[model samples]
Target: MGTETETAPLELDDIQAGALRGRPNPYAGAFLFLRIDDPQDGRTLVRRLAKVVHPADDVTDPLTQTSFSAAFTHAGLCALGVPEESLASFAPEFVQGMAARAGLLGDVGPNAPERWESPLGSDDVHMVLVMLAPNRPQFEQTLELARVTIDDLDGITGVYRQDVFSPADGRNSFGFNDGISQPCVEGAGIPPTNPGERPVKPGEFILGYEDETGSVAPVPQPEVLGRNGSYLVIRKLYTDVAAWRRYLRENASGTDEETLLAAKIVGRWPSGAPLALSPDEDDPELGSDPSRNNVFLYGDDDKGLKCPVGSHARRMNPRDAQVVGEIRLHRLIRRAATFGPALPEGVLEDDGADRGLMFAAINAHLGRQFEFVQAQWIGDGKFVGAPDEVDPLAGAHEDHGTFTVPRRPIRRRLRDLPTFVVNRGGHYFFVPGLSALRWIADLAD
Candidate 1:
């Protein structure tokens, strides 16, 4: 509880907009991965990017609402000629990269790194550029700006590009409203979405500030490069909508029971209504209200009568509930978006379309935050008293997986939970501050 009362101002102008701000709903965007063939050319592209990237403060204005951000993989930094000592200063998990840690993260079976998209886990992929805007036109404008920086560069080659957009209903591919429980960072100029929700220390997400531990977590070497920067964990996940629908149809007795069962697994309705508050049924009004949607806790539902103890939401946040580890320390700022065509309503047959989500988890400490939550909470359900079970929706489920739905008298257990979400590709990135971008751009060869 070090410095719990101390509030330090964040360098909003130095931090990248994508690091702290959430994307607007009903938005359009793209993720572009580039490979650096030459060091000088990479530096040149970075020099141009320094001017294009927006600071966090710029996002507060409605007029300039577009988000254009850049991040580098460990290989990317090495390609940029970052000094050996400076590169070594980064977190070990980041230095090892996501692909190498696949086993620990439950990225096995069909989701293995060897099966990942081409160049995703490979060293050829250096930098990742993300753009988000309210509409297609604005999105195009931002994309054009990025193109200008790299289109003519002979050394930087575009390896992969995936366009992402929000669905009309503002729900994920699974039909559940996501992005509902982001942590409020203190001094980030954003208020808490839920009443009484304490603002997490800025150091928990940004470097050079006092964190919950009352100390500054280790930053990448050299203050200029690490201060105001944060680590970003990106993963491309493919959702099998048809399979999910088929599972529900087969297990549930009726349409109403199907919906209730789905809610019990996810801990929320498709409308984002938490089961802790609306345990009986979906409430569209309460689900849409930001103040109410994420306000409830699990203290009253210890027996999992409302939201199941091992449900996706309960395992993800826990929210004042009794759990193995401190929930607040493992909080993540999720900036996830849906991509590809939406499966038509009530279709049970596999259409063979590539539809999924681009999940970006931002935090200062990758080990304590993203990796910890993924390994301990989502992959293993022991903390919630269900060791054999995993997150029903996002877990790395095999045909043998089971989900427990706590209910009256005897609890219902779902068996043979097929994997709904498959890991397509991903990597760890260092989202440097604006000044750090310039420093990298101006680095000596």
Candidate 2:
């Protein structure tokens, strides 16, 4: 890790709030995609957006109720007439976009880009606007503010929009608590939620700062357009709630066993209590406590007795468990929210509802952070010493996969695991800083 002498205080006022801060629980948000038909119009839209988008420091304001963040696709940058030299400086994955690398992300068969929704991976998608608020009214108000930026602008067109919200219970479509275990960014002024968490270097998530390797990563030049910026990976995943529940029921013997099976697969109970801390049963109190819920490490449970090494949460963040690579290098700031209606509880049959999660992974290095986690961790199980296993909850299981649960006397192994999550569509975006937004808007022909 970088020493204090090499690290500097973060420029919170220049950075976008979404890149560092956690969203409010039970929040209302929307993601809006846009296409730039003309460079001048796109610049005008960015100029207006720069005014409403909240800075990282805005979270301290008591009156602040909404946050607006703006990001541009590689094609969007080109549409705005970014110079060739500057464009070449971006991460190669971002330049190629998410759809082009679908295979690496396990987006094959049903999740393939060819089957993705229109305008998502296409070149027509140039800009993305994310609005988040604590309630419906505030969310709508922020949406209106964003709409005005492109109102009557013939060159800028709205492509797609997804309304997302966190349920009162804070569980996702799969009935497990989401958005837990985020890496604390150094000098972000926000203390670690868990005492066991060591704050990661700011450069790991924001540009122009020293990363864990004690070196500053090369940002897209000129520095004004890249400093304090970060990469935003947006993916729309559809969770098959019915399928997940059915698998649990079929794998276990009874009601108590069924719930245990579900918890084993996720590495946590439905209430967010991790198995490492509450091994026997669901502890709602422990799960609700932010400080204690994510405080446990996997060093003691290396044998997969409590939380299986191949479980969804464990694979995502190994946390001192001696995984294939250093866990710190792959840490990501996730801001994911559930979209569509929650399936009525206890319904094992398919409801045929288009419900899932809107996942946004924030980081400075696209290749080593977001893409690495997706391709190597979630998509495969080689890192955890389970070469054939994958993340049971989010992995692309093709109806023939298996999951092993370590236990006393005899171990339990689940066979024929079906794919529970499907990739609907997504894109890689470059979230520029406040000054960079203006620089982009003020670009000359």
Candidate 3:
């Protein structure tokens, strides 16, 4: 019995653009999550949470959910207060009861196994209540605002919720244009994505309401592999601008950063044309163009020619576009972002500190979606031409030095080092809806 009301869809693109321009911090948030117990009964919990958050209107469509996001102020990353959290606001008995069930009350140790990822991440809270939307769904405004006020009360600051533009373009510290080349939604068969192997549909990742008690499943047989399961891949990426620059300047004899970065990191230039098309060059306008960005694939002949056999995009989603014989069934939407500040000027200032992306993705299944990409393409060099080259962009080959991946066979090892990217910190989470949120509040003291 889920229903939605109507409201003007809030523009995530514009909102992201504004944040990028102004450098928004991530302190103000009303993060709600399923109470540890709520999972036992999502339906009931959903109604209760919805009642509190959507008293004014039906929690209805995503637009309403998004608009309700538009409200109020939040603390910045450099805030100086620690506000009251659920545990502090809720009754001690209830808090104690749920904490016991969650096994948190039993473990007083600083480190707990139940936790995922390291450093600050999504697990710190459940559903994030951004105060950007308020019209369509306003019932939760009070609870959301209360949370922000609580954070303000404490001395904790927050970073901006990371959401970028259509293509997430922005300049890194070294100032070279970044966010240039990203993977298309694979089988979108639409703009932004290349015309090659299409990505699976978006609905596959979120809840398929119709699936609960529907006629036919969205993709025919839900019992196969993808069903409701979503693949969650976590990567702790580190950024090395100076090293990247050094590579650019050294390789500048033939290629420039503008050309090289896109090729190595994105497997294609900015134009969306695969390097398989132009191995030794770049297409800046092509890369930046929305209309013509994604238009190539890894066919047998065009394979090693336009794009390197081991290109990031190719490795991630081989464009032969083949699936379940020819089902072409998978796509990885990178719902991730960069962390840390621009690298400081001095070369030596690179203290190996923070400066990278916390990459995350949602998929239909783990094996078909993420693991297959990583194990088959990225980790295995045999797929391309070598045996050791993982994804230059996301590979975790520590042995690969400033310019070389060491201690690996030439056939298995890399010769000319590719510091496509560095890892920093990250984690994965299941993003539930408004209903799952109250469960979290109920868990609080």
Candidate 4:
């Protein structure tokens, strides 16, 4: 389950930030989904984008400008003139798409593609352009520039666009802090924020490097086409803030118990404090400290006395906890950001407003990392010794969900957990390395 010892330093300049650590979190951003109306024109747009796309090592520069990342769906690649043979090298799940494989990912009923946004599974969305800026004006400006650029191109069409933002406290609509448990990547030169985290092999999340198997990950050939590239799975998930809050209010006896119940479901406090270290109450100091916040392991809490095994955090990344396979093999870097407005503070009733997250799971080996975790861990409870249980936070429960909280004498079980999260839409994409982007632009088809 371990990778080979140190190789040489990674060529950070050649890799895109999305494939390494991730683009910096901007307060404002937009996701633009596009289609190729004319293959030649689309190629020209790719060529133009290669010049301004951000690289993995650019953040260190004080003068670095707003960031943009580009990724293509299988149809987008085909439209770009990539041969069928090359496309065949891609994982089947990616080629098939998220909605088509919903059963495997455990997305059923209201969460399935049949109920997703109109453009989600259509050929109308061939590529996705992600733009981010620290301020709204800059974000709007970048968005306008791309909008104009796409409009001017005879072969490209803007299919859809979704705006995103980060609230003051950086919490999701559910009012809990997010993006605190991202995995660190080896050879990326970024220090681990969590003391309990070890750098994951670059190949686990980035192609063209040794993976967990100690060999360069297999990729679509010619090497230039696949090198430094990675698979990106994006989803727009709606959070039922009213339902979530109501459940907390009714289940716990008081504020303390309510907060603890929430913590047990997430494996962390609203302030980001891990339950393994602070089970009864939030430790704001620890939650705010990068070194302390994510430092706890589940090994000590196997029975979930400190943190429930079926909690969202534990189900996503069970560090050192008992599992059917090596946890490292399923690691993925989360590049998700909250979308929609936060419910007014202290308001617990339904407002009929749409709110959720624009999630991006970046990984090198899509099958082993992203797909495996979603199918085996997040969608199934068998791994944590709870065969009938699903993730209380994200799972697609058949009838009613049960979350067992380890307590003395008799275990406390939270029953009838409704679907707090709904899948609005999602897709699979291939984010090429900087050089690969250039190669794609220069394609002679």
True-structure lDDT of candidate 4: 0.82
Query: Each prediction's TM-score against the native?
Result: 0.97, 0.97, 0.54, 0.95
Q: How close is candidate 2 to the true structure, as a TM-score?
A: 0.97
Compared with the true structure, what per-residue lDDT tens digits does model 3 show for residues 1-445?
1232212222222121111111122111132221122222322332343343322122233323432221111111001111344124222322222113222211112212234233323323222322323231342454555354434222222332432211124443334333323343312222354545443433333332221122212321222111222223444455676665565565545446445554655566544445665656766666555455556555654334445556566666665733222223344555344456666654533566556655555543334445455455655566565665666655545565222221223412224554545433222333223333333323322
Whole-model lDDT, model 3: 0.38
Q: Output candidate 1 Cα RMSD.
A: 2.0
Predicted structure with the largest lDDT when compared to the true one: 1
For residues 1-445, write the lDDT of model 2, one tens digit per residue.
Answer: 2233235689999999889887866689899999999999989888888888888987564224566899999999999999999999998999999999988888899999999989888999998998888888888888878777788789998999999998878789888887889898889988787777689999999998988878877789998998889999999999988888888888888999998999988999989999999999999998888878999889898899999989888988888888788889999999888999999989999878889999999988888998899999998888888889888888998766899899988988899999999999999999999999999999987
Model 1, range 329-406, lDDT digits (tens) per residue?
Answer: 899999998998889999999799899999999988899999999999999988989889889989988756999888
Candidate 2 ranges beyond 4 A from true positions: 1-6, 61-64
Off by over 4 Å in 1: 1-8, 59-64
After superposition on all C-alphas, the RMSD of every candidate to the true structure, in Å, is 2.0, 2.1, 11.7, 2.5
Residues 1-445 of candidate 4: C-alpha lDDT, one tens digit per residue: 1233436567778787656654444468888899997778988888877777778887563123566889999889999888788889876778888878888888789888889997987666799998877678888888887876677797887788888888878777777777777777887877787767678888887777787777776776777888778899999989988888889988989888888899899888998888888988899898878677888788777898888888998899899898899888889888777888787866778798889988888988777888888888877889989888888898877797999998888889899988888889989999888888888888887
lDDT of 4 at 25: 48
